[model samples]
Target: MNEMGKTDTVVQPQSSLLELKKMFFLYLPVCIGGYIVFRVLIVLPLWFSSSTEQLSVLRIIFIILGVGALAVVVLGAVRAPRWVEKPIHVHYRHWAPAFFATLVILGSIGGHLVASAKINSNLALEKVKAHFEKETAEYKMGRNAQ
Candidate 1:
Protein backbone atom coordinates (compact mmCIF):
# COMPACT_ATOMS: atom_id res chain seq x y z
CA MET A 1 0.00 0.00 0.00
CA ASN A 2 2.81 2.39 0.80
CA GLU A 3 4.45 1.80 -2.59
CA MET A 4 1.33 2.66 -4.49
CA GLY A 5 0.03 5.16 -1.93
CA LYS A 6 -3.36 3.49 -2.13
CA THR A 7 -5.55 1.55 0.25
CA ASP A 8 -5.09 -2.28 0.07
CA THR A 9 -8.16 -4.35 0.74
CA VAL A 10 -7.70 -7.61 2.62
CA VAL A 11 -9.09 -10.59 0.81
CA GLN A 12 -11.19 -13.03 2.82
CA PRO A 13 -9.72 -16.51 3.01
CA GLN A 14 -13.21 -17.96 3.37
CA SER A 15 -14.05 -16.83 -0.13
CA SER A 16 -11.22 -18.93 -1.53
CA LEU A 17 -12.16 -21.86 0.64
CA LEU A 18 -15.77 -21.58 -0.41
CA GLU A 19 -14.84 -21.52 -4.03
CA LEU A 20 -12.69 -24.60 -3.65
CA LYS A 21 -15.36 -26.40 -1.70
CA LYS A 22 -17.94 -25.67 -4.36
CA MET A 23 -15.63 -26.85 -7.09
CA PHE A 24 -14.91 -30.07 -5.24
CA PHE A 25 -18.57 -30.69 -4.59
CA LEU A 26 -19.37 -30.25 -8.25
CA TYR A 27 -16.47 -32.37 -9.44
CA LEU A 28 -16.76 -35.17 -6.89
CA PRO A 29 -19.77 -36.83 -8.48
CA VAL A 30 -18.18 -37.08 -11.92
CA CYS A 31 -15.00 -38.45 -10.47
CA ILE A 32 -16.79 -40.99 -8.32
CA GLY A 33 -18.88 -42.10 -11.25
CA GLY A 34 -15.87 -42.64 -13.45
CA TYR A 35 -14.06 -44.53 -10.70
CA ILE A 36 -16.96 -46.85 -10.15
CA VAL A 37 -17.39 -47.47 -13.85
CA PHE A 38 -13.73 -48.27 -14.36
CA ARG A 39 -13.68 -50.65 -11.43
CA VAL A 40 -16.76 -52.50 -12.57
CA LEU A 41 -16.19 -52.43 -16.29
CA ILE A 42 -12.44 -52.98 -16.37
CA VAL A 43 -10.44 -53.74 -13.23
CA LEU A 44 -12.78 -56.11 -11.46
CA PRO A 45 -13.28 -58.50 -14.37
CA LEU A 46 -9.56 -58.73 -15.06
CA TRP A 47 -8.66 -59.31 -11.42
CA PHE A 48 -11.47 -61.77 -10.79
CA SER A 49 -10.42 -64.22 -13.45
CA SER A 50 -8.71 -67.39 -12.23
CA SER A 51 -6.23 -67.12 -15.10
CA THR A 52 -4.93 -63.93 -13.59
CA GLU A 53 -3.10 -65.98 -10.95
CA GLN A 54 -0.69 -67.13 -13.65
CA LEU A 55 0.58 -63.55 -13.77
CA SER A 56 3.54 -62.53 -11.64
CA VAL A 57 3.02 -60.78 -8.32
CA LEU A 58 4.74 -57.72 -9.77
CA ARG A 59 2.09 -57.55 -12.46
CA ILE A 60 -0.62 -57.67 -9.83
CA ILE A 61 1.15 -54.93 -7.90
CA PHE A 62 1.21 -52.81 -11.02
CA ILE A 63 -2.53 -53.34 -11.46
CA ILE A 64 -3.19 -52.25 -7.88
CA LEU A 65 -1.03 -49.19 -8.40
CA GLY A 66 -2.97 -48.43 -11.54
CA VAL A 67 -6.19 -48.50 -9.56
CA GLY A 68 -4.67 -46.03 -7.15
CA ALA A 69 -3.63 -43.86 -10.06
CA LEU A 70 -7.20 -43.85 -11.32
CA ALA A 71 -8.34 -42.72 -7.91
CA VAL A 72 -5.87 -39.84 -7.98
CA VAL A 73 -7.01 -38.81 -11.42
CA VAL A 74 -10.52 -38.50 -10.08
CA LEU A 75 -9.26 -36.45 -7.16
CA GLY A 76 -7.34 -34.12 -9.47
CA ALA A 77 -10.36 -33.55 -11.64
CA VAL A 78 -12.27 -32.58 -8.54
CA ARG A 79 -9.64 -30.07 -7.44
CA ALA A 80 -8.74 -28.64 -10.83
CA PRO A 81 -11.65 -26.24 -11.15
CA ARG A 82 -10.93 -24.64 -7.80
CA TRP A 83 -7.28 -24.15 -8.65
CA VAL A 84 -8.25 -22.41 -11.86
CA GLU A 85 -10.43 -19.93 -9.96
CA LYS A 86 -7.59 -18.02 -8.29
CA PRO A 87 -3.86 -18.32 -8.12
CA ILE A 88 -2.62 -19.13 -4.61
CA HIS A 89 0.81 -19.32 -3.05
CA VAL A 90 0.32 -22.77 -1.54
CA HIS A 91 2.75 -25.60 -2.31
CA TYR A 92 -0.08 -28.07 -2.85
CA ARG A 93 -1.50 -25.95 -5.62
CA HIS A 94 1.86 -25.83 -7.29
CA TRP A 95 2.27 -29.59 -7.05
CA ALA A 96 -1.18 -30.53 -8.31
CA PRO A 97 -0.24 -30.62 -11.98
CA ALA A 98 2.77 -32.78 -11.33
CA PHE A 99 0.80 -35.11 -9.13
CA PHE A 100 -1.85 -35.54 -11.80
CA ALA A 101 0.79 -36.21 -14.43
CA THR A 102 2.42 -38.86 -12.28
CA LEU A 103 -0.90 -40.56 -11.80
CA VAL A 104 -1.42 -40.77 -15.55
CA ILE A 105 2.06 -42.13 -16.15
CA LEU A 106 1.68 -44.76 -13.43
CA GLY A 107 -1.67 -45.83 -14.77
CA SER A 108 -0.31 -46.26 -18.29
CA ILE A 109 2.66 -48.28 -17.06
CA GLY A 110 0.42 -50.55 -15.06
CA GLY A 111 -1.86 -51.16 -18.00
CA HIS A 112 1.10 -51.98 -20.19
CA LEU A 113 2.47 -54.39 -17.62
CA VAL A 114 -0.78 -56.28 -17.41
CA ALA A 115 -1.04 -56.58 -21.19
CA SER A 116 2.57 -57.66 -21.61
CA ALA A 117 2.23 -60.29 -18.90
CA LYS A 118 -0.70 -61.83 -20.72
CA ILE A 119 1.10 -61.82 -24.03
CA ASN A 120 4.23 -63.37 -22.53
CA SER A 121 2.24 -66.15 -20.96
CA ASN A 122 0.64 -66.97 -24.28
CA LEU A 123 4.03 -67.05 -26.00
CA ALA A 124 5.45 -69.34 -23.36
CA LEU A 125 2.59 -71.78 -23.87
CA GLU A 126 3.22 -71.85 -27.59
CA LYS A 127 6.93 -72.52 -27.09
CA VAL A 128 6.24 -75.39 -24.75
CA LYS A 129 3.84 -76.95 -27.24
CA ALA A 130 6.41 -76.68 -30.04
CA HIS A 131 9.12 -78.33 -27.89
CA PHE A 132 6.78 -81.19 -27.04
CA GLU A 133 5.93 -81.75 -30.70
CA LYS A 134 9.63 -81.78 -31.70
CA GLU A 135 10.52 -84.33 -28.98
CA THR A 136 7.64 -86.58 -30.06
CA ALA A 137 8.78 -86.49 -33.70
CA GLU A 138 12.38 -87.38 -32.74
CA TYR A 139 11.21 -90.34 -30.63
CA LYS A 140 9.05 -91.63 -33.49
CA MET A 141 11.98 -91.42 -35.96
CA GLY A 142 14.29 -93.30 -33.51
CA ARG A 143 11.71 -96.10 -33.15
CA ASN A 144 11.38 -96.39 -36.95
CA ALA A 145 15.20 -96.58 -37.32
CA GLN A 146 15.39 -99.34 -34.66
Candidate 2:
Protein backbone atom coordinates (compact mmCIF):
# COMPACT_ATOMS: atom_id res chain seq x y z
CA MET A 1 0.00 0.00 0.00
CA ASN A 2 1.25 3.50 -0.79
CA GLU A 3 0.91 6.63 1.31
CA MET A 4 -2.25 7.39 -0.66
CA GLY A 5 -3.88 4.20 0.70
CA LYS A 6 -4.76 3.05 -2.81
CA THR A 7 -3.73 0.07 -4.89
CA ASP A 8 -1.58 0.73 -7.97
CA THR A 9 -1.60 -1.76 -10.88
CA VAL A 10 0.58 -1.89 -13.96
CA VAL A 11 -1.03 -3.26 -17.11
CA GLN A 12 1.03 -4.99 -19.79
CA PRO A 13 -0.27 -6.13 -23.17
CA GLN A 14 0.16 -9.82 -23.88
CA SER A 15 2.36 -10.90 -26.79
CA SER A 16 -0.25 -13.42 -27.92
CA LEU A 17 -2.63 -10.53 -28.42
CA LEU A 18 -0.10 -8.85 -30.64
CA GLU A 19 0.39 -12.01 -32.69
CA LEU A 20 -3.36 -12.42 -33.04
CA LYS A 21 -3.60 -8.86 -34.28
CA LYS A 22 -0.96 -9.63 -36.88
CA MET A 23 -2.80 -12.77 -37.97
CA PHE A 24 -6.02 -10.83 -38.35
CA PHE A 25 -4.38 -8.20 -40.54
CA LEU A 26 -3.04 -10.97 -42.75
CA TYR A 27 -6.31 -12.89 -42.84
CA LEU A 28 -8.44 -9.90 -43.87
CA PRO A 29 -7.10 -9.58 -47.39
CA VAL A 30 -7.10 -13.32 -47.95
CA CYS A 31 -10.71 -13.66 -46.87
CA ILE A 32 -11.81 -10.79 -49.10
CA GLY A 33 -9.95 -12.18 -52.09
CA GLY A 34 -11.37 -15.61 -51.55
CA TYR A 35 -14.91 -14.24 -51.37
CA ILE A 36 -14.44 -12.28 -54.58
CA VAL A 37 -13.01 -15.27 -56.40
CA PHE A 38 -15.79 -17.54 -55.24
CA ARG A 39 -18.45 -15.00 -56.19
CA VAL A 40 -17.07 -14.37 -59.66
CA LEU A 41 -15.99 -17.87 -60.61
CA ILE A 42 -18.87 -19.80 -59.08
CA VAL A 43 -21.77 -17.76 -57.76
CA LEU A 44 -22.31 -15.16 -60.50
CA PRO A 45 -22.10 -17.68 -63.31
CA LEU A 46 -24.43 -20.11 -61.60
CA TRP A 47 -26.93 -17.42 -60.71
CA PHE A 48 -27.03 -16.00 -64.23
CA SER A 49 -27.00 -19.28 -66.10
CA SER A 50 -29.82 -19.97 -68.56
CA SER A 51 -30.47 -23.42 -67.15
CA THR A 52 -33.48 -23.37 -64.83
CA GLU A 53 -32.24 -26.23 -62.68
CA GLN A 54 -28.99 -24.43 -61.93
CA LEU A 55 -30.89 -21.72 -60.03
CA SER A 56 -32.27 -24.34 -57.68
CA VAL A 57 -28.77 -25.51 -56.90
CA LEU A 58 -27.61 -21.94 -56.42
CA ARG A 59 -30.48 -21.31 -54.05
CA ILE A 60 -29.47 -24.29 -51.98
CA ILE A 61 -25.89 -23.09 -51.83
CA PHE A 62 -26.91 -19.65 -50.62
CA ILE A 63 -29.22 -21.15 -48.03
CA ILE A 64 -26.41 -23.25 -46.69
CA LEU A 65 -24.05 -20.32 -46.61
CA GLY A 66 -26.62 -18.22 -44.81
CA VAL A 67 -27.10 -20.92 -42.21
CA GLY A 68 -23.40 -21.24 -41.76
CA ALA A 69 -23.08 -17.53 -41.19
CA LEU A 70 -25.66 -17.60 -38.43
CA ALA A 71 -23.92 -20.51 -36.83
CA VAL A 72 -20.61 -18.71 -36.84
CA VAL A 73 -22.15 -15.68 -35.14
CA VAL A 74 -23.80 -17.78 -32.45
CA LEU A 75 -20.70 -19.82 -31.85
CA GLY A 76 -18.59 -16.73 -31.55
CA ALA A 77 -20.94 -15.15 -29.06
CA VAL A 78 -20.98 -18.19 -26.84
CA ARG A 79 -17.26 -18.79 -26.95
CA ALA A 80 -15.91 -15.27 -27.30
CA PRO A 81 -14.21 -14.93 -23.94
CA ARG A 82 -12.43 -18.22 -24.14
CA TRP A 83 -11.66 -17.70 -27.78
CA VAL A 84 -10.01 -14.36 -27.08
CA GLU A 85 -7.52 -16.04 -24.82
CA LYS A 86 -6.72 -18.72 -27.36
CA PRO A 87 -4.53 -17.61 -30.19
CA ILE A 88 -6.08 -19.94 -32.73
CA HIS A 89 -9.59 -18.63 -32.21
CA VAL A 90 -8.91 -15.11 -31.09
CA HIS A 91 -9.64 -13.15 -34.24
CA TYR A 92 -12.72 -15.13 -35.23
CA ARG A 93 -14.90 -13.40 -32.69
CA HIS A 94 -13.94 -10.08 -34.16
CA TRP A 95 -14.57 -11.09 -37.76
CA ALA A 96 -17.55 -13.40 -37.47
CA PRO A 97 -20.06 -10.56 -37.31
CA ALA A 98 -18.81 -9.04 -40.51
CA PHE A 99 -18.85 -12.41 -42.19
CA PHE A 100 -22.38 -13.02 -41.02
CA ALA A 101 -23.57 -9.66 -42.30
CA THR A 102 -22.00 -10.17 -45.70
CA LEU A 103 -23.55 -13.60 -46.08
CA VAL A 104 -26.97 -12.27 -45.12
CA ILE A 105 -26.75 -9.39 -47.59
CA LEU A 106 -25.59 -11.59 -50.41
CA GLY A 107 -28.18 -14.25 -49.69
CA SER A 108 -31.01 -11.72 -49.74
CA ILE A 109 -29.85 -10.15 -52.99
CA GLY A 110 -29.43 -13.50 -54.64
CA GLY A 111 -32.83 -14.69 -53.48
CA HIS A 112 -34.53 -11.60 -54.85
CA LEU A 113 -32.76 -11.90 -58.19
CA VAL A 114 -33.61 -15.57 -58.50
CA ALA A 115 -37.26 -15.00 -57.67
CA SER A 116 -37.54 -12.18 -60.21
CA ALA A 117 -35.94 -14.22 -62.92
CA LYS A 118 -38.25 -17.16 -62.34
CA ILE A 119 -41.34 -14.92 -62.37
CA ASN A 120 -40.29 -13.17 -65.56
CA SER A 121 -39.61 -16.45 -67.33
CA ASN A 122 -42.98 -17.84 -66.24
CA LEU A 123 -44.78 -14.73 -67.49
CA ALA A 124 -43.04 -14.97 -70.84
CA LEU A 125 -43.98 -18.62 -71.15
CA GLU A 126 -47.60 -17.82 -70.37
CA LYS A 127 -47.67 -15.05 -72.94
CA VAL A 128 -46.27 -17.35 -75.60
CA LYS A 129 -48.80 -20.07 -74.75
CA ALA A 130 -51.70 -17.62 -74.98
CA HIS A 131 -50.53 -16.38 -78.38
CA PHE A 132 -50.24 -19.94 -79.70
CA GLU A 133 -53.68 -20.87 -78.45
CA LYS A 134 -55.24 -17.80 -80.04
CA GLU A 135 -53.60 -18.57 -83.37
CA THR A 136 -54.81 -22.19 -83.27
CA ALA A 137 -58.37 -21.11 -82.48
CA GLU A 138 -58.44 -18.64 -85.39
CA TYR A 139 -57.17 -21.28 -87.82
CA LYS A 140 -59.84 -23.76 -86.66
CA MET A 141 -62.62 -21.17 -87.18
CA GLY A 142 -61.37 -20.40 -90.70
CA ARG A 143 -61.38 -24.12 -91.56
CA ASN A 144 -64.98 -24.49 -90.30
CA ALA A 145 -66.11 -21.45 -92.40
CA GLN A 146 -64.70 -23.09 -95.53
**For candidate 2, lDDT tens digit of each residue in 3-116?**
899887776555867777877776677577646644553346334755556665665666676666667667666655655365653466466465645656565456646645
User: How large is the C-alpha RMSD of every model relative to the true structure?
Assistant: 9.1, 8.2
List the pairs of residues colliding in candidate 1.
Answer: none
Clashing pairs in 2: none
lDDT of 1 by residue, 72-119 (tens): 656666655465566343434544444554544454464545556675
TM-score of each: 0.43, 0.52
Decoy 2 TM-score against native: 0.52
The C-alpha lDDT values of all candidates are 0.57, 0.63
Clashes of each: 0, 0
- Evaluate model 2: give its lDDT: 0.63
